[model samples]
Target: MGLEFLDVFEQWANSYDESVGGQNREYKAVFAGYEQILEAVTERSMGHVMEFGVGTGNLTKKLLDKGLNVTGIEPSVPMRGIAEAKLGSKEIILDGDFLHFPDIINVNTIVSTYAFHHLTDKEKNEAIAKYGKLLSKGGRIVFADTMFESVEDYTNAIVKAREEGFHNLAKDLETEYYTTIPILRTILERSGFTVGFKRCNDFVWLMEGEKQ
Candidate 1:
């Protein structure tokens, strides 16, 4: 679970939208083409969607607008509150993380954006395994997050962030649980998903995994 960052999310609740909108130069590249990334995730999702890390309900809104049934899960109280307020009383946004969500039914598609990296590689593997067991054949997982093509690329990204005087971005890169493509592919495949990745920007990539 990524609950260890609850305080960070609470603090970021108010400014998360602005930061993703490219207001924070240090994180601007990370969130480049923010709307398109959300749309990309939304476009891949269908039928009874369950969204993890629904921060501020941005992606939730898109899924809802697409006429998909969505249940949102957020670990941070303030973030959930903001998302609830934004999406209004009609939608259900629950308090949970990837591994600790309430039991949901008929969730054929799971979608998340810019949030899964909070989990360490081990946790990521566990989450994928859990989803593999929960989903039936043809169910899908669509996530857009900052992932590297390789460990060398991961290291280079941190170095570039540091060279650009993006100390916060560099520290975040080093501190968070960002992982490489091979590891994610291995985990998803081991868990029985046929997965694929598409670059969304310099930093983010869209990972779509269909359960087989």
Candidate 2:
């Protein structure tokens, strides 16, 4: 059978929280920068907030703490369970996939953290179209995840993994979906979003667009 993003993630369910989902305290501290980006997005946002792939609510507390009305879409049952458990009775935790949600929510803006990169190119493009179609006029989307900086990073990672006998770690590091900046920007543009910014580390991006 063909591989799916959810499939691989499901297999990594146990490690999902500790690895990159920001469940651990150290991970959360390291991810503080991304949280700042999400906060800025929330502050500038004019309407509702929707998260397409909210894994374990790493950013959930930050968003909810702001008292912003936010909803999230997650496909992994285990991950969803963790998130729902943390966000009890909030009613915003919906068990669904971003590209195949049964209901449509037209909001002012949408944001996600570290989740979009898991999707395949086809699903990513489809999601842009599907979600963009649901954006209210003047709405926007802002998200940040791994954006590839160099092919050498992939090569070096693989090489290091082989030397260290850490195949699983290497495989997980392969999620540099937005290999180049322009490619992702082009896709978003075609889907009616003007590229705001795409940044990493101390860098930050605020690519957004009005529903046209």
Candidate 3:
């Protein structure tokens, strides 16, 4: 699954920013969530930030404008190339997934947008634990992505996707795993984080967990 997804992204890397879902009406909802997330992060005083899956550098460009130092982790070679082009040749973008991205230290914030669902549930927990360990004291993770309440909810979402003519998307959803708010909160709390969440809509959510 990982290699397959990677191949798909590699193929789409050059045109991702102009893809159907990237700038179409279908993306308005995601853009709205991105705006809210930018606002939320801007209100806080975050020092060093690590962003995983920095696809196409849309959000990374905004963070750079805020004068924040960001380290990006992306596995796709072509995608990383595009991101580096957007962020400039010097900005550091490590070529690995979150679990394997190296040399991270003293990071105050770790953020990912619409990325983690690519991971299995066990991998999600593992990534959360890694985030807890990598961050400096009082550091937090601000994750914005598609989240569901349960497997049933995920199933319903898949059904809706198919009904909306997103058959391929629905098919992909069958194999991908997404975490729920309750499960995510429990995992973070167990890992010594104080958790908070906001629902952006039926499918998208923002979760923050500050290390204690």
Candidate 4:
């Protein structure tokens, strides 16, 4: 699935937290209100959660603190190690990605933050379809990630990043498969979910989809 970015994650493992904490100016806007975003995702999640891309276990910790049973899946070894260390021995983070994960049972809510855009639109569709089949009625998928309102907005964001001399941010925007709202809505609805979106920050939106 998103394993192609494994090396990136591996390299980022040590600095991921700092980057999200707004220590890095280039990504500050991207991770603006990081704590609040994680809280929003945690608030929406329900029983037996499956968390994809549990980098450093930040969101995973929030879910656990909310008294929710969580299964964390991370593809990067170093990221998983850091998460394991952070979450301690009680929690087990599995090896997986958006499309491929261990056969987890009773995962009524799926939660992820700032990570789903690693998948291309086609892969995103496949992942959503897989989740649709796996979840029962009333189950949910709550994700917060960078997405655009339109193609024009997407283009403008990259241009703005470039103008601000955030070449890394600009390149990331250009390289990754960041998609638009309409596309995500279509995918979620087609997969039999009633979905809604709320802006979390300038670069992130919280997408909540309930299985129908």
TM-score against truth, every candidate: 0.98, 0.76, 0.88, 0.98
Pairs clashing within candidate 3:
none
Poorest stretch of ten by lDDT in candidate 3: 20-29
User: By summed lDDT, which 10 consecutive residues of candidate 2 come out lowest?
Assistant: 21-30
Candidate 3, lDDT over the whole model? 0.76
Predicted structure 4, TM vs. truth: 0.98
User: All candidates' lDDT scores?
Assistant: 0.93, 0.64, 0.76, 0.93
lDDT for model 2: 0.64
Off by over 4 Å in 2: 1-3, 7-34, 37-41, 149-167, 175-178, 202-212
lDDT of 1 by residue, 4-68 (tens): 88888998899999999999998899999999999999989989999999999999999999999
Tens digit per residue, CA lDDT, model 2, 1-212: 01257776576567755655456443343254665666665665555778777777766666777777787877777777778887774478777775666574557677776666666667677888876788866787777665544556546655775576665545656643534455567778888876766554522345555566
User: If both were scored by TM-score, which would come out higher, candidate 2 or candidate 4?
Assistant: 4
How far is 71's C-alpha from truth in model 4 (Å)? 0.4
Superpose all Cα atoms of candidate 3 onto the true structure and report the RMSD in Å to 1 decimal: 2.4
